[model samples]
Target: MYTKKNYTIKRMLSWTRRYIFMFILLSTIPVVLYEVLDWKWLHLPWLPIGLVGTALAFIIGFKNNASYGRLWEARKIYGGIVNASRLLATMVNDFITNEYALKDRTDAEFFEIKKSMIMRHVAWMTALRHTLRVKKPWETTTNNKSDQEVMKKLHIQEYAFTLEEELKDYLSKEEKQAVLSKTNKQTAVLNLQSKAIKELKLDGLIDDFRHVEFKNMIGELFTLQGKAERIKNFPYPRQFATLNLFFAWIFVALLPFGLMSEFEKIGETLNGSNHTGILFQFISENFVWLTIPFSVVISWIFFTMERIGDVSENPFEGIANDVPITTISRGIEIDIREMIGDDKNEIPKPHPEYEHTQM
Candidate 1:
């Protein structure tokens, strides 16, 4: 979702700065105690810490892979929707005809029918996207404070307006009211579409073969909708996610304890052998303290990787990093309406970009 060629160091620091501070504070404690207070017992061996680091790496790797899988799957589902939408629009424009109509109708009337069906398809997309963006209890984008702070700097599509207001543009007054009354608004919209298509068939505007084809397209849309909903509703296993955080912090906490001693040993080795100059002696004596920054930097990497996986797991939560479903839906609307010869001004423009990423 971050489309820039590369995130600047300043941008990466902005995201991880808070944790960096925490890591520095954590790492500094043992250094001060060992050097100033002569608390020699405050050090840990590298072997145990090394083992923990290896295990944590494997755990974090699994989590990132799983999270990426969910994100990619959501994108693929929406890609399918994009293809199916264009197909549905083309069929709506070409498949229905006056050739077999039960009653005589003018060209303008047939155009109106095509327009209504296309508008209803737009309504279906709107309803589906709105439903997908609803906040679930498990969604971190809305639930976590740090993530909420990040979201404050960006725009989300569903946050811009109420569903009722947007639906009015695509559905007739009665149809909008009917949809509003339903618990599952997207499903209701699709049902209305099916009913309308059946009516067109009964009136002989669309022949039997075309009616069956339309129904099949409708089924594919439903399939795509269900696939997106499944990822949105079912989350990655929480035990792994929860424990991975704990394990990463455990490694971070012990990292500096082990690192301080190793760095001090290097400093001691440098001081024990004679140095060539005062400057070299000064550097040797002071090298032990370098562990603070080194520890913070190392710990920040592990924490940042874990946080990335945590945030990337859910792709439709209306965050900037999501699948951009709202933008994709609006694009479909533009294409469908334009195929029916609607004015450019009448078709909505694409959703605006936020921080170089479209929602």
Candidate 2:
């Protein structure tokens, strides 16, 4: 996700520059008509516009809260995955031993077993993150032209490589084929893990108690996977999202109309005064043009708030503002591999951040 304390105003403007231009154009129309064309009847009352603004603000606030809730929930689910993965690595390192084995093996053999299990778990994480990064019909962050431009600067690891390519490093040829063949690659990888654990139990490398514990941990991983899937599959209520957009645009369209009259009234009041200097009179008489900037700023605020909610609604769309699943998964892989004492060179390094953002 965006790791910086805040986005620079320049960057924000760059991302929304097209819309800002539209707002400027929208604001300038009524001022030109009322001032140059002398169409005084074109201006709207401020009271009704104020009421619409209030209603739009409430809806935007509500949508932001709900969108943040989904993002936070996705983060919590990945946090659980990180903990469970570490626990599984610790269990593999400590529980499987010669003390309980039906047939004793060499130190190299035991190490191989531990390494295989750990690597398989990493493969499962890779499969899961790849699944989450797949596009859903409702996800729009990457579809926007502005968002697409910003994404070019951020390196999203999941999109950089295919699932099969990454899995090759962690899975055997037969296992990788099995995983890729399945419709649900993550579920297939997990099933392979369970089978391997079961075989270890039968060989007495893992005792009965440890076997059950391993099964329980796998179940927890499944639960976490399902939780992430739920958020990925379901979207924030579209009806609310649709209406929120419509309302925000309606308020923006009406804003300048109301503002033109308010500024004109101030200009009229100054024109009637005799005490004001020439400079003050000049400024006051043209004050209605100030409506353009005021309207642009006000419209930009409402539209930006609406855009924030829209982008945040899906946390797994592989955008800069997502939950950083690729980074999290890579971290888990590194931590678990180190725990099992795999070759330092063989263990992959953490995914690097790009433009102060981790994917």
TM per candidate comes to 0.95, 0.96
Error of 1 at 13 (Å): 1.7
lDDT of each: 0.87, 0.89
Candidate 2 clashes between residue pairs 3 or more apart in a chain or in different chains: none
Off by over 4 Å in 1: 1-7, 355-359
Instruction: State in Å the error of residue 311, model 1.
Output: 1.0
lDDT of 2 by residue, 62-121 (tens): 999999999999999999999999999999999989888889989899999999888898
Per-residue lDDT over 108-135 for candidate 1, one digit per residue giving the tens place of the 0 to 100 score? 8878898898899889888888888888
TM-score of 2: 0.96
Which RMSD does model 1 reach against the true structure? 2.4
> For model 1, what is the alpha-carbon lDDT of residue 238?
93
After the best TM-score superposition of candidate 1, give how far the Cα of residue 116 lies from its true spot, in angstroms: 1.2
